[model samples]
Target: MEKLVIGLVQTHDDAEAAAERVIDCGYTRQEVSLLMTEATRDRCFPSPDVAPPSSTFGAAVAMSVVVPDLGFVVAGPLAAVVASAVGAGITGGLREILITAGVPRHWAERYQAGVRQGGILVSVFARSERDVGLLHLVLDDPHMTSFHTEAHRHHAYDTSF
Candidate 1:
């Protein structure tokens, strides 16, 4: 159980220009997916499940943003009861809740009780571009990006059933 490299910046463009090319390459958290559009995911995370799967338009709020050290845009939780209500001190001890493994806890208690003014992070797993370091500033078609480890397994930490 030792692997970490998630830099999947698959884009059609516009999530702030894929978060400004994932913050100019230094990298700092990313797993967004608006796959469909939905007004560019509701102008970047003003969500109500934007809705886009068929074709018309939907599926915005593509998330996963935690520009730590680089500073700003700090929010995470791609599900799991909103990362266990954002309880634990986030990132430390890997307390992203939803039973652990990153982001949740009511979207980090609504971004630490500020009511979320920032967002990005909608990856249900499968992120390995070498644990994410801007990965050459967004895939750039290295065979449509490549890197995987078990791909999907689910059930992390458990949080009691």
Candidate 2:
């Protein structure tokens, strides 16, 4: 995998809707993890087996997609989501958030540059009538080959999630 794109969707009323938006953006139903505020502390996963707590925010779902080539075609939806989620597109706060979420600073910079150079965005994160918090996005470093190899190894043996 060249990049691991992670997106976080927080909604106050309809967690399901936010989840559906992620699904609509091309991620499968299984790829998205729905976490309620009560089931987690600060949206972090404590353990693999622990269930999330109930939150007044309703739910915070995390979804991811791995891009092997790091091409524009594969990153279209993600770019769109980032563009829409952050009002100023890929600059200012959104750029900072991506870096904070584990996307290497260099990769984030390149992504922004690509967008600025005229890349087409197909779809963005779905907006809801209810309060929707920051839609965080991260693009992991492409130079890390060992993690991809391990993931491939596990993927070959285990198809269940």
Candidate 3:
């Protein structure tokens, strides 16, 4: 299983600087990818001076650094470096992102239990890798109806047994 340490840095409406920061933080070329999804461009990072402070003031850039073997240990400093570069605070932690990704509440709880039992909680985000890995699971699917339908079907099978 692959482990990813994700971080979001609110850029000063500058995607270039954000990308550079990700690289400067010791991320390999292959491990770090820029966040450029439509939903992210439209919602999380709208036009400059148009969005409220509650929303992103300018471009909101996110980067995912793929930790080869140990994600949990490296996540903290990785997040801090990204956040410091853009002067933005870190958002919720990994468990929060997992819950936001539509993982069932019970599943999250179970994972926590497993962690307590010395089991590593490796998570997989089912959406597009870039969207989930970079956007911090905030980008909602545009095709929600169909997505929910499929999710419901999958949930039914899981619960049936």
Candidate 4:
């Protein structure tokens, strides 16, 4: 069954490492997404003076987006969900994005608050139990608080971004 495996990390350093490991676990860059505040991105990420932007998050699927209501910086396939939320006329896109991705509304609210409070979200979509398990293992890595899933449902319609 297809699933969206997700977890939260307290620090940006942990977020970066966990995301790299997600890629190392054999999931395509296209399958991963990250959401954090712009402040978190600025504080944790290296400046352009140090190295090319793509090197930090990998070149294949790295992008920086600015979403209002919380100044979110979204990267990877989940950006599609944000766009869908916007296209649907919702404000404060993150919570809606999480819900539209099949997360329950209550959990989505908490996740939205979590991100606002400086937690980084790491998420991946997988169609196989193997891939989902691999993601769970990564999310259970050091510094991960816990993980959640929305299995076999694509509430966002087109999760292929």
Candidate 5:
């Protein structure tokens, strides 16, 4: 089985730092995803932003999907999924993308609002319970919070596939 987790950070610096920590922790960029608005995209991620090809998660090149109000950029595993959705002519926005990434609908909606307001949603996926626990340890710092408020105030978002 697979599982998903998310963490929310309020600053571009924090977001970038957390992403680097994920990489340093030995999770490849392919297993990580980032969600942020267009403005944040300009300020934060300025690279080619192409996710490295992965045999496990298919592959995704750069493709932009402009939703009505919030123009956001997606990278990593979810990028492949969103690219497929756009190819199929589905225009669902960030909320839908989060839900597809295994976030519960309620948390997805809240994370969407947070991203809209300039927070970054860092998503990660794992194939085992041990890996998920490792992610929680790597991410459960004071700076990041999941959507669950009180229960997750010191934890990242967690879900399973």
Candidate 6:
């Protein structure tokens, strides 16, 4: 099997908007890919003008859900959506949606359980060397791991196939 260097980034947007940005940026559905959230589409990326906030989770859930629906294979996002703000509801909600979206039911349950126990929920899967390279450039952090390791004990493998 050919190994494509993969990199992941946490993104914010709905499928249409994320797809639009990818297409508008000159990448075809083949060259660049993204996963977006329903809330993100519903909220329009939460304009900088807003105060008190409107949503906790955004494109992360959408990405997880849409991964299987994409016509082409999708590399995963690097970071899972962590309810960044306070008063966010049970972390299980996001996990449940994502599991139902693409994650295996068993893994999804464990992953969500991990989150409730203070585990990180986001991960990325790269499909090509170019994407992996670009991901590092976008993040600009060398310390980040280039590939998955045992540390990600709760992560789910790609289930699209």
The lDDT values for all models are 0.32, 0.32, 0.33, 0.67, 0.61, 0.34
lDDT, residue 29, candidate 2: 41
Q: Could you tell which candidate, 3 or 4, scores higher by TM-score?
A: 4
Q: Report clashes for each candidate as comma-separated counts.
A: 28, 4, 0, 0, 0, 9
Residue range 1-161, candidate 6, lDDT tens digits: 11222222223322333334344434443433332343323333443344224323332333433222221112233222222211234234545444534555655555444433323322333344454444323322222233223333333344232
Residue pairs in clash, model 4: none
Kindly report which residue pairs in candidate 2 clash with one another. Answer: 38-53, 38-54, 39-52, 39-53
TM-score of each: 0.27, 0.25, 0.25, 0.76, 0.69, 0.28
Give me the overall lDDT of model 4.
0.67
Q: Pick the candidate with the highest TM-score.
A: 4
**lDDT (tens digit, per residue) of candidate 4 on 90-159:** 7756787777777778768877887877788878876676666666677654544343344312222223
Instruction: Evaluate residue 22 in candidate 3 and report its C-alpha lDDT on the 0 to 100 scale.
Output: 42
The 10-residue segment of model 6 with minimum total lDDT is 66-75
What would the TM-score be for candidate 1 when compared with the true structure? 0.27
Ranked by lDDT, top first: 4, 5, 6, 3, 1, 2
- Tens-digit per-residue lDDT, 1-161, candidate 1: 21221222233333335444544554443333222223323454444354444321122233433333222232333433333434334443222332244434543343232212223222323234343433333422232222212221221222222
Using lDDT as the measure, the top candidate is 4
In lDDT terms, how accurate is model 1? 0.32
Superposed Cα RMSD, model 5? 6.0
lDDT tens per residue, model 5, 1-161: 56776777776556656666777777875677776776866665443434322212213113433344438777676666666656666567877766665667887788788887777777677656666666665554465444336544333334432
Q: 17-132, model 3: which lDDT tens digit per residue?
A: 43344444444333443332233344444465675554322323232333222223212222333334234332443343334434466544443343333332212222333433
